[model samples]
Target: MTLNSGRGLLAALGLLAMAGSLPTFAIAQQAGQEGTPQAVPVVVAPVEMRPVAGALDVVGKISAIDRVDIQARVEGFLQDVSFEEGGTVAEGDVLFRIEPDEFEAAVTQAQGQLDAAVAQQSLAQVQLDRAQQLLDKKVDSQMTRDQAKAAYDSAVAEVKVSEGALRSAQINLGYTTITAPVAGVVGRAAITKGNVVGPASGPLTTIVSQDPIHALFQISETDFRNLRDRASADPDNVKVTVGFSDGTEYDQTGSIDFIDATVNQSTDTILGRAQFPNADGVLRDGQLVRVKLESGTPEERALVAQGAIIADQGGLYVFVVEDGKAARRTIKIGNTVDTDVVVRDGLAEGDMVIIDGLERVRPGAPVLAQPAPDAASSGQIPAAETEADAAPAAADDKG
Candidate 1:
């Protein structure tokens, strides 16, 4: 390098270093030449008001509306199990058959005794009539008539006793053939054929009614009060729908039919039961399910798409374009319905929220807002594409 050129370069560097703000002044001049900053483009939609109802979710257990235990009413060897295990049975259908030989013999013996008693009663009545006739004709003494009357009365009492014994035998014979007390699905047999079963035996099996099944659940007392307030006439009639653990929803809806008389003090919850129609028998006893309750009259609520919601350590927030500038709004949210979320606070109807191109804008920055293609005044969200979701939308607007 030439000595003169090297000396000149060193002198320039020294002058620039001595006046450091000279570079900053030159950059400011360059920015002035560039004019105004361009406004960021954003997609926007309006907030909307829609009817919403309060909801509560709780776990439930399926139960039969009517449950019965089958047992032998008479003592004898079980000759047959007349039902298929886990099969449906109609009321009055035979479920078991105990050996009938002994019952039949007792019935026969009792019938014979009743016949003998009837014969004796007739003979005694004839004797009493003859004795009375003789006394009226002065051919028999009063004592003779009286004695005949006594014998007749005794014979009548014996006949009455025998009739009772016969009825008892017939009842026992009927009991030997066990019948279902209600129409329901039967569980596994506790005893098999050839086993001795009688009144002393425990339940031979169980039966649970299927249609109009019960879903048992628990609710806090506060919730019960809220539900009752929703429907004053029927506290238990609050509407409920069920879902399975696998996220499949039950087709039929249920209503609360019963509330336990007492509260479970330890848990501070009251037991509630909802009845659902199960004509297809899809609901089974002891099954677990999710129960969602809808209560209270529908109230107007502002709703926004779930995609517009943003959460952070400070809770949740969304963006809106206000006065031609991108604005941020912190929101308190409630239960979500479909893709729409209930906005409990921090937003109002007709608010233009910025939902897209959020990465290019900041709070209070100029934005070029455009309507989301699916946007509408109604609470329904415009279907969106191209990755901008989780906030409101806005485009540049003149203040």
Candidate 2:
């Protein structure tokens, strides 16, 4: 072959080799691009409509409906203590017995005097009758008959006086036995047997009714005005629930029974009272508790899981999926009920709020959203969220 033909042949071979490798390189580059990650996976829930109440929370104290102090009415040595300390008692039940020797003797003396007066009155009546008969026959003077009549009147008056004395003596005798003035549970006795007791003596014991208890609380003037306005609009809407210091909630619900007519000058607050049916006797007098009051009729409000809420310098916000993209929205918040918060503004029903994978989410970022596990059974997002998720929103909103 010629030199030029040899060179052309070598060039043709080189060209063919380069063409053979180009398709493999192109395939590798395409595979690498296809392996890149997709949008971040997230859990989301839909906003819901629920009935909500404007509620106020405050500290309160439990008190009894009826309380009394037991004291002696008469003077005598306490011969016997007839009741068990810290036990239930009924009205008119005897609690103590004082020595009755002196009182009994006075009663006996008064009775004897009354009997003697009655005999004297009988004898005087007989004498007056005889004197009247003699005067009719003109055997006795009119002066004698007049004297007999005066004696009979005097005896009648004496009988009445004796009767009064007897009644007084009997009352004093009855006072020797002390009885309970009301039905309730009695406290420890201040006086025991052999102690002298009288009206001047201090209270011997205390008794307090055990059922239908009262819960007393105080509210600021502003809150009181709001409550009064709400009450005026709906009188039967105010309801109260109590919680103990140990984080236990009371089962029975109560109603507001009283509000003080005058405001307290020192605190600038008003006193309020709620009545609770304490059939179980779980409540006691002077017990500190947490009181929550909900007033006004139930109204429709938008609610979202607390986890879905977010916060920034501007205000509280949340991320919602729109057209498969995360959209940041500012929201106004209201009272918290359970795991959900009432969204006063900026959210609508059926809006999908990002709950899980919040750390990976950003405003305007694309997301692959799925219902949270708790909401899977309902075929939608849950109505409430964990309290930990709600904390940031509360702080940002200053709620």
Candidate 3:
């Protein structure tokens, strides 16, 4: 019995020694794990709210309300183009003068004849009066009185004929000078000095009325109906602003003045015109421009930085960080402005978005969001790098 007990004690001692060696083996495994480094951190931003305005925009053209082609009215060699090409002129301004010396001489000859006729008429009247008085006193024959009366009448007719000739000559003389019929800025003079021009001749120049200019644009019937409905419903007036082809907005605002009564058959578009006070004459006729037609009461809208939008196989999307993980979200977008886009759906205020290091993120990846290092320094990021993306990624995880 004593021998058996001694063997059992020795077995228990060996088992204890093996258990101590097992702890050292576990320590080596733990040391190896501690040697590796952890992943780097990512930055993110919370979803923020901003205000936007509702607007309707379309491409339009600028035009002069009144455009005129000036034609020559007098027959003569263009003595002098009194106004410079592309100069402003007023009504009754003389444009050109024809040779008038021949017409003047004709008038002088008519006047001389009229004077001689008057003198002859006076002498005939004296003779007629003397003959009449003699007849009254029975001192002369009736035939003699009649002859004097006939001479006096013939002299009066000669005087009347001479007066008619004088008036005709004077009128022909006045037709020599041509004058401006309207006030406006004149275009290139088609006829120069010494060029023969007449009433039958073609246009001499063109004139465009610059003040109270107009902007012309066509919109579909659907758009027109929308505008009309708004105008009728609201008491406030509809306003419009214009932009040039190069994306510069004009400094003026215009009101809708004229709308076509019927839609165009071929185009199905309604013609509309807006007037502006272009006193400086900067807006030219037929220049292309973009017009924003705003109607109804303005409403507040959700706007995101333009840089925050992303595209994928599905559609436009953005990334947001939530609970320290990246989440992807799809968004419905609306009008885009200078550096922002109006979001019609799929986003809200106060959501955290991932803007920086988007490439390092994936759906459901763990993230450590710090103040986006790049974002803190610069607020203007590319569309892909805006907070709208990061906030959705962060907030989407909650949904």
Candidate 2 per-residue C-alpha lDDT over 102-207 given as tens digits, one digit per residue, 9 for 90 to 100: 9999999999999999999999999999999999999999999999999999999999999999999999999888898888789998998998999899998898
Each prediction's RMSD to truth: 9.0, 12.1, 11.9
Off by over 4 Å in 2: 1-51, 135-143, 232-235, 262-269, 298-399
Lowest summed lDDT window (length 10), candidate 2? 382-391
Itemize residue pairs with steric clashes in candidate 2.
Answer: none
lDDT tens readout by residue for model 3, 1-399: 699999999999999999999999899878766653322256555454555445667778988777777776546666676787778888888766777777789999999999999999999999999999999999999999999999999999999999999998888778777677777788887777887777788887877778788998998998787877876744146777787766567788888888888999999998888898887877888889887777766566766665567897899987765555667878888765555567778777655566667776777775656565544566533334343444545444434
Q: Model 3: how large is the Cα RMSD against the reference? A: 11.9
Ranking by lDDT: 2, 1, 3
Model 1 accuracy (lDDT, Cα): 0.84
Q: Write the per-residue lDDT of candidate 1 for residues 250-351, one digit (tens) a residue.
A: 899898788899999899999988899999998999999888788778889898877778888999999986666668999998765545778999999878
User: Model 3: which ten-residue window has the lowest total lDDT?
Assistant: 380-389
User: What are the runs in model 3 whose C-alpha is more than 4 Å off?
Assistant: 1-53, 102-175, 233-236, 302-399
Local accuracy by lDDT, each model: 0.84, 0.84, 0.74
